[model samples]
Target: MPGFLKAYVRWVDSANRAIGYAAMLLIFVMVGILIYSSIMKTVDIPPLWTLEMAQFALMAYFLLGGPYAMQMGAHVRMDLLYSTWSDRRKAQVDCFTIVFLLIYLGFLLYGGLSSTMYALEYDERSFSAWRPYMAPIKIIMTFGVFLMLLQTLSELIKDVAKLRGESLS
Candidate 1:
């Protein structure tokens, strides 16, 4: 691979790793939120935002961590036939199938951006009693999707390199 492509791969991997690690902390935050909610409920002082906030944290955790999961090859796959394939064969198959992934991510990004824009423009809020503005989470979700797209492209590059009997690392 060329110098620029190598740099791009390195940069994306580093950024996603940092984001993923930060996202991992959200699980603890979610747990704390739920625990607080439980304690408040026991005292007959349940907060209206606890449940919804916890849900939002969960969403952020997964979405933000997705790119790192893909980068680490932690995403699920069917192993019935794939586990038996040779490395070159796997690379070939990945190179071909990655087109579908790219297409799907493209559509997802488009829709996410549109929804995020609407939220920002209209100051959209959830229908829950807490009624928090939706733009912040929408923006985070869209950014996560964008990172996933970049990571997917990096994977495609790596697959192509593997097919050529080269190493990006």
Candidate 2:
């Protein structure tokens, strides 16, 4: 194994693992706060914005941590097709898959940006008891899409290098 490839993989894995921890903490906090609010509501002292924030936080958790999941091989995949391929074919498939994901993410980014802009221009707010900022949640879509795109590029590069007999780890 080449030293540089090992170092690069280690760096990416370590950075992503740290990010995963932070995301998990956020998810835990959001859940805890919602439960506490629900309990408080029984005493007629509900946290008015807890539900709203929880909804946004849940979305944030999913999108923000999506790439981390992919990096860790935690995403669902139909490996029946992939398992049949030689390593070179598998790498090619991976490259193409990354391309598809990049295109999909590009659309998501555009749509998310448009939606966010529209919401912001209209001063949109959630139509609920909390009336939280809707645009911010929409803006999260952009961030999430970009993260996915970046991670896909990294994986594609790694696979292509592997196909050339270059060790990434």
| Candidate 1 minimal-lDDT segment of 10 residues | 160-169
Q: Taking the tens digit of each residue's C-alpha lDDT, what string does model 1 give over 21-101?
A: 999999999999999999999999989999999999999999999999999889999989999999899999999999999
Best by lDDT: 1
TM-score of each: 0.98, 0.81
Which residue pairs come into collision in candidate 1?
none
Instruction: Write model 2 residue lDDT over 38-135, tens digit each, in one string.
Output: 89999999878888788778888888888799898899988888778898998888887788788888898888888889989999998898788788
Worst lDDT 10-window in candidate 2: 1-10
Give residue 83's error in model 2 in angstroms: 4.0
RMSD of each: 0.7, 3.4
